[model samples]
Target chain A: MKNNKNTVDPFENEPDFLAQFDKKTPFSVPDHYFESLPEVINDKILKKKSLKFGFDKMSYRILGPSAALIALFFVVFHFYNTPSGNTVQPEEFSDALLNEVSVELDDYMIYDVYAEIIEETESSTEQTSGNETENDEYIDYLLENDIDINTIIEEL
Target chain B: MEHYSDDQLLSMFAARESANYAFNLIVRKYQERLYWHIRRMVIDHDDADDVLQNTFIKAWKGLDNFKNESQLYTWLYRIATNETITFLNKKRKRFLISFHDVEGELTGSLEQDHHFSGKEIELKLQKAILTLPEKQRLVFNMKYYDDMKYEDMSQILNTSVGALKASYHHAVKKIEEYFKNH
Candidate 1:
């Protein structure tokens, strides 16, 4: 309470010139500023409140769905991209397709396909054997005529 | 309009039904005093109006958290004072100017302000007060113009009474020196 005396008489040492000035503020306002301020302030408050509410609502309406859609997209992508035991991989797909074709074929159709494959294999072997015999005959002819084998091979 | 005590107003505001009504009453009661307080800090009436509106808006938002620890008037005053200071600081920051330069700008604007109806001496006194630091100016205004108690100012400013007195003393001496020089 050391300054209590000073606090009680704050203007005790005020200069005469300073004391002569009235306490009235130098500033003024537009007509009836106070009369309408409460309403103006209330309107502003309401506006601010609604603006905040609108932001929250917009988040729910837009951002919420956007987030959900992004999550769904990731989930779907992960579901398709990740290899699961029940899902067919690229390597397994061809085997699966062949198995499916085989299962779909009738007994007669399967027998026909197997027969055709066997016939093609036998023909290919016969052609190879014939080629080997021809090559042996050409070399024998070359030896019998005492022709230069290297020159005969080059001519052949 | 009927006058309601601060307790009555607080209790009315506590209820959802009468909250708006109570707030309107509170605004009506304190708007002029708060306006002048803000107007003095910010020389422009428009700026003061904006600051006052902001102060009330903040009060509306924060009143729920108010624990009635201090007087409602003082609490509202604190909000007004803070809003004014913030407005001034933002002006300074926006222009990238120092505090003293911002005050100089205010002084310049004061001359051009149509809302300023004060005589030449009053304007000179205002300019002299503007030379002090922000806190000293506030103390000087509160003490010299409003004659607010140092105790109430302590709660509003969150500063010690001794410091406030010293600030007021320094502000007075400085203003006197400024007048003597000019």
Candidate 2:
């Protein structure tokens, strides 16, 4: 018997064996689809970053003007309400002088009380020192007037 | 003219003011391969299109960091695979479907889809593949469809070769059994 296995061609018998899968190619992608991808992506990233940077810069810029305006408004408002260049009238001057007089009177009262306390303390201290000095002078006179008691007793 | 490697092409694009030529070359080289890889995973043309664009965009942005340790195609494949998987995961999350149920639903959809060329056969095959656990399905796809060596697959997937072999064998047996039963 001739080898029947050798006679049979595996490929010949199954012409359409792999046909179902034949249509399936290595899934191909379209051409040049990603060529512009980098530019698109870079543009997006750069635009986003730039927008954020610009917004930050603009906010600081806006704040600079706003802060300056606020400061200027404050200064202008202060100066506008301020009494300057002989703006005080006679009545205002009189009212201010009255307030100054009251303040001076209060200061004078405080000084008067302080002076009285200081004078009283000084007089008391002087009296005490005078008495001490008198005692010292008497002691000195007694010492000078005293003869030698031992010599007198010996003579007796 | 000598064909430029992916790294070479990318460098040319980076250096040249008009990188369209080099970039176009990269697209031509990778598009078909990436499309099919994503198409098989996402199973929708529109989803595949979005993922493909995202993959290339990511590649373009990350090309500066690409060290050329692996082949450029492999690196792109990694990105494409990750994007497809991430898209599927997000879709599943949006749909509030369990991961297990997502596979079942995808299989059912494949079976009913008319857009697939070999609808019945491909659906049957896909359904059988869907029956596999996620890792096994990944292994089977890489091994059976992409014809990737286990060593390369291990490198791409960061799995042990032994583990991948077992997963592939299990997937193949399960699929063969499914075909037998059906």
lDDT: worst 10-residue window of model 2 chain B = B111-120
Model 2 reaches what TM-score against the true structure? 0.57
* lDDT tens digits by residue: candidate 2, A127-146: 65465455445445535665
Tell me the tens digit of each residue's lDDT in model 1 across B70-153: 999999999999999999999999999997898899999888999998999999999998888998989889888888989999
Worst 10 residues of 1 chain B by lDDT: B164-173
List ranges where model 2 is wrong by over 4 Å: A1-156, B1-3, B16-20
Reference-based lDDT, residue B175, model 1: 90
The alpha-carbon lDDT assigned to residue B124 of candidate 2 equals: 74
Report how far off residue B29 is in candidate 2 (Å): 1.1
Tens digits of per-residue lDDT, candidate 2, B1-182, equal 35788768978888757465666667667776787777777666667878887887787667767786887787888898889889989989999999888888777666655456564676677777788877788777777677777777777778888788777766777887888899
Clashing pairs in 2: A27-B32, A28-B32, A29-B31, A29-B32
Query: Model 1 over residues A1-156: C-alpha lDDT tens digits?
Result: 486665676543555556868789988889988898999999988899899999999999998999999999999999988887654443353354445532333333333333344445657777555654554464455456655323422442
DockQ of predicted candidate 2: 0.04
